[model samples]
Target: MSISVVILAAGQGTRMKSTTPKVLHEISGKSMLFHAIDAAKKISDDITVVLYHQAARIQESIEAHYSGIHFHMQDAVQFPGTGGAMKGVHVTHSKALILNGDMPLVTMNALESLMQGDADINMSVIKLDNPSGYGRVVISEGSVVEIVEEKDCKPEQKEIQTVNAGVYCVKKELLESYIPALSNDNAQKEYYLTDIIKMAVDEGKPVHPVIVEEEEFKGVNSKLDLAHAEEILQRRIKTEWMKAGVSMRLPETIYIDSRATFEGECMLENGVSIQGASHIIASHIKTHSVIEDAYIQNSDVGPMGRIRPNTKLINTHIGNFVEVKKSTLTGVKAGHLAYIGDATVEEGSNIGAGVITCNYDGKNKYQTNIGKNVFVGSDTQLVAPVTIEDDVIIAAGSTINKNVAQGELAISRAPMKTIKGFFYKFFGEK
Candidate 1:
């Protein structure tokens, strides 16, 4: 009762107009092939990826991330067609589920339904408003008889709306027997996998067709198709997050990565983008904030905050126009106009307005360590290779180049002097 999955990822995706392979093109921050592969993994781990056209590069890109994947290269010598690709695969199970890598929106429920059907062959089919170039499903006596490609169909057959979705669950033995029988006599002169549908009917194998929503089979073949698919995916993501008690003031204005996780009641204001596998918990992110690869908990950040990778915040408040990169802030409040980079601020520190940690020194970046209850005053510049220990107070407008010890007051500024009536003297108004 085992099943093998064959992912058809060999197409060059010529319509995408990029040097990168079409399956490599992303939707919602994940590659199209990965979306298909992830779903297939949920069903079965024995996946054979049929590769062609930049096959090595595709293999290299995904091999490290996805283990136990069998790659079969479809090259010129193989006469690399879909049917030709299947003929060479070494499937271990009696049943094989074939899927196209381009279709990302195919649900696991539909696939499982196909698996659970009591038939020798089951393929997912969708009824489109305009079938156009898709192969139409010919039906008779309350069941699917065969699939007719648009090029091979008559004028009446061309009017059928139910089209082949390129998703199939077939018996491996039956598939192997007829794969060589597929002919290449069409105008395109390619051995199509669709011909097997007719072959199965002729062989008296029960063909079960599972109808799905048209959007579930939306394939990404071009840049326009990619965008359309992205909209569908984003809408799905937003709806799921919303259902999980995360609030977005304007959902359409956000572009959140699919891998990002959120916990507790969080409020995301307009124009807030959270990307790259970040985690959030009970936080309020204000408008126009960009956070990538960071972790936040019970923190409030910006109407315009830019938090970069590897930053961790806890019980912190980072205000407007502040940018923090590669820093860990715990119980810190840096309200408005600051940049804290490559620094670690311990609990109960107040980083005042217009403060910056000068972490870079031309050759390499250095770290600034600030201990508990340290008060960094306004307009202060903390030069790198420095530390302000516990209960230290950095005076306003000072540029500290050296470290300050515990409970000490550090200031590096020239003495203030008065120049009376300087404006009158310069203007010659006497």
Candidate 2:
């Protein structure tokens, strides 16, 4: 059955207290809205995002990342509420799965479960120990009769532990028919989508309840909520990787981006952060190191190393305090304290400690190429646009600015000078 997805993102999350829209807030390195959209896309291609607050900004941001998304600007001033957000939205399918944009942790499996129930409306509900702030789902005779808002719930209704999850899979016909007739006569003067439940029940339409875990439907309305969601998502990501043969020490301290992938037995130490589209294959990332948008295979990166974007390391060892950016190191070993940026160090090369590739000259950036069997000594600086041919040796403390031919030695250092008895004269026979 084809199902259309409608993500409601019209509310200005005032509790979040930020210039950015509430849905734009990030959890697990992606905006909460994107996470909802991502889960929605898995269930349906016909997706519509309803926006009101910062509608243009939200549309522009989403368009940069996704295509074929239909955005609807809600009339927030006149018809304001969840029901009003769907004023003129069109659904391509007979069934529409409505999701809240702030609920970033909702998974595809949970959404799919709603489709299993054969009813006019399938509403998600969770049994919380304390359903204080959420609307209570009133079930009568094995059917969901209505949802009573927390503010309007009677004393007995307040004890109902089953709360609405704010997610629904409804027939498109019902939405088009009843959404227009919704009234905002309550205390808040906002049209309530929950009212549709009582309306459906009055007409003897089947209103089924799909019970889900509380964690899956967590809504992020504040920074603390965002942090809790991020923690949950991070644990999920890390636990999945661990089950897939990737090991981590002090897993709580390590952070992995959702876009990062691991293959074939990788290990991450304490304080290791892997972000972006990094692919780690059979490698070990040591303590406090950060790997971002890089590829590593059969290598070990520092106790404090940083592998920046566009870098690839194969069978290499990057030691403590080493930072490699936009470079490829093949079968190379740089022990410690090296800055290799915009450079390529080929196989059988050894980059000594304190070595740096001066690949930038304030105005422009350049590359440093070191050929096979090259040895860059400690504290040596390879200036921009420099090349060291095969079997070339760079002496310690030398600053090489020109290219060196095959098997040649390059060094540029001032001669050492000493003044005899200078220390004794300055100390006055001390």
Candidate 3:
């Protein structure tokens, strides 16, 4: 059977109180809508998203990752809410799965369980301790009877803990057939998709309820809920990495992106953030280090290192307070307080403290190439478009602007002279 998934992302989410759209808010490294899309894609590729309120910005942003996703803009005048969003969006199949964009914690396993239920309609419900502000699920004997919105429920229904999770699997024809019957007679003056529960019941169709865990169905509507979702995601990420042989000092403090891949034993200290496709193998990542879009192997990096994009390290030691970007290093020891960008350092090179590769010359950027066994002294700056050949030595506190041949000692400091009374003449007594 062809299955289509419709994600409802049209809500303005005024409760979030930010100018940014709610679905665009990031948890871990991806948008909430993409997380939903990621799980939905596991089941079906013919997915349609109903969008409104920053729809173009949302579309253009996630398209780079999920370019195949189809979009539908909800008409504010004609179609105005969850019910209207489903009615407005187009589906390609007879049966479809409907999901909320803000529910990032909805797993593929939960969705699979819902689809496995043999029924005309499958509705996902979660048992909540405090289910206020949600549509309560009304179950009679062993069957689901109705879903009462919080505003329209009676005093007894208000006490029901099981609530509608805003996820469903239904025949597209059945749902579309009831779209015209949805009434905007509620407190919000919006057509709710939850009203279809009563219609399914009236038609005597088998409306099976799939009860999911509360955490899996948690929806983000505000900053607090977003934090909760992020916490859940972070824990999940850390646990997965730990199970895969990545050891950490403070696991709770470490943050790893979903795109990062690692193999072999690795140590991650507290406050380490590995983001955006970073690959590490058999390396020790120390405390307070940040790495993004880089590759490292058989190396030790920082208590406070920052590895920027497009950098590669092999058997390298990037120590405290060092930042590297767009560079490649092989067996290079850069121990402290240096900035290297757009450069290549060969094997057996020692990059001393406070050294900088001056890569940008105002309008253009250039590369600095250092050959094998080169020694760059402390407080030195290699002005870019320069090369240090094999066995070259750069003296301390020098600013090297030109290339040095093999086995040469390059120094740019002024000649030292002895002036016995010059200090007295210049300062008159310090």
Candidate 4:
């Protein structure tokens, strides 16, 4: 049988209080919408995401990440309500799984349980400690009878701790039939997807309750809920890393993005944090180098090289015995005591300490070019738009503003002033 997943992502999420669409908010590193999509892709061959309210932005983002998934617009403006929103979709499938876009923590295993087609209809339900604002599941004789929303439930129904988790799997033909019969007679005048449960019971259709572990059904609705979901995502990532032979100095203290990839035996020191689309491909390290929450794409580092905190790199290659601090290195070998930024260090050069290539010139910025095998003196400053010829030497404390000839020394300094008995003269005021 063909299995398809339909993800509902049309809600505007006024409660989130942000311009970004609710499903687009990130948990750990992956967007909430993408997390749900990835889980669904593992169990189903075909997946459709329904979008609205910033639909263009959501579609573009998802297309960039997963280009093959089908996209559908709920078009709340035209369709008017939830029931009518899905009216025209036609799929060539026997079964489909319905999911919400904001539940990022739902795993593939949890979804597979609901897809076991032994029952005519399966719905995920979880028992909540305080199911105050949720729809409570009503069961009699171990069979699900109905689901009552908090507002529509009677006093006794409100006390039922078992709540519907808004996930369902059913025969595609059954869904097509009942979806058209749904009514908007409820208080909000909005078509409630929950109504299908009652419709199934009335027709003597067996509804199976697939109880989900509390963690698998957590949904993100507000900023607080987003944070809670992110914590779970981080723990999952850390556990996977540990299983793959990567060592985390303090796993609980470190926060790694979900998209980060690390090779085996990589050691993240205490207080090390990796963020963005970064990866370390087969690199070893020693303690004391703090790699901050920066992006490293396709790079390797040698042991004892210090990656100063907050250094951002992309498509770059790094070597050993290098120390980078507060700079952005974009290409190969841009390391090794390299004071790069607002500067660029070419391949294969030893950047001496106290050697600064001055880039700022009062009103505008400038560049400095140093040739191969050039010895820059300690405390030397090469002013911008200047070049040091190959095999040239710059004297100590020189402030060079002009180019130097190849294989020659350039020095700029005021003549030293000397006075005999200067110390005695200063005391006598002579």
Scored by lDDT, the top model is 2
Q: How well is each residue in 164-184 modelled by candidate 1, as lDDT tens digits?
A: 877888888878788867777
1-430, model 4: which lDDT tens digit per residue? 3788888888888889999999999987779999999999888778888877898999999999996688777757645465655656555578878889988999999999998756668999898899988888998876799987788999999889998888988788888898878777866777767777888899888889988988877889999999988888888899998899878777787777787777646666554556655566444433334454444544555344555545655445544455554455544453344344344443233455456667777898676766666666666777877876677878877988998888898888889998999898779865
State the weakest 10-residue window (summed lDDT) of model 1: 75-84
* Model 1, global lDDT: 0.88
The collision pairs in model 1 are none
Return the clash pairs for model 3, or none: none
Between prediction 3 and prediction 4, which has the larger TM-score?
Answer: 3
| Model 3 residue 343 CA deviation in Å | 0.7
Provide the clash count, candidate 3.
0
RMSD values, in order shown: 1.8, 1.2, 2.0, 5.3
What does the lDDT read for residue 417 in candidate 1?
98
Q: Global lDDT for candidate 4?
A: 0.74
Task: Give residue 123's error in model 1 in angstroms.
Answer: 1.5
**Tens-digit per-residue lDDT, 190-232, candidate 3:** 8878778788899998788888988888889999999989999
Model number with the top TM-score: 2
Task: Write model 2 residue lDDT over 1-430, tens digit each, in one string.
Answer: 4999999999999999999999999876788999999999898989999999999999999999999999999998998999889888899999999989999999999999988767999999999998888889999877898887788899999999999888999999999998999999987898888889989999999999989998999999999999999999999999999999999999999999988999998999999999988999999999999999999999999999999999999999999999999999999999999999999899999999899999999999999999999999999999989888899999999999999999998887899999999999998896
Measured with C-alpha atoms, the lDDT of residue 114 in candidate 2 is: 88
Backbone collisions counted per model: 0, 0, 0, 0
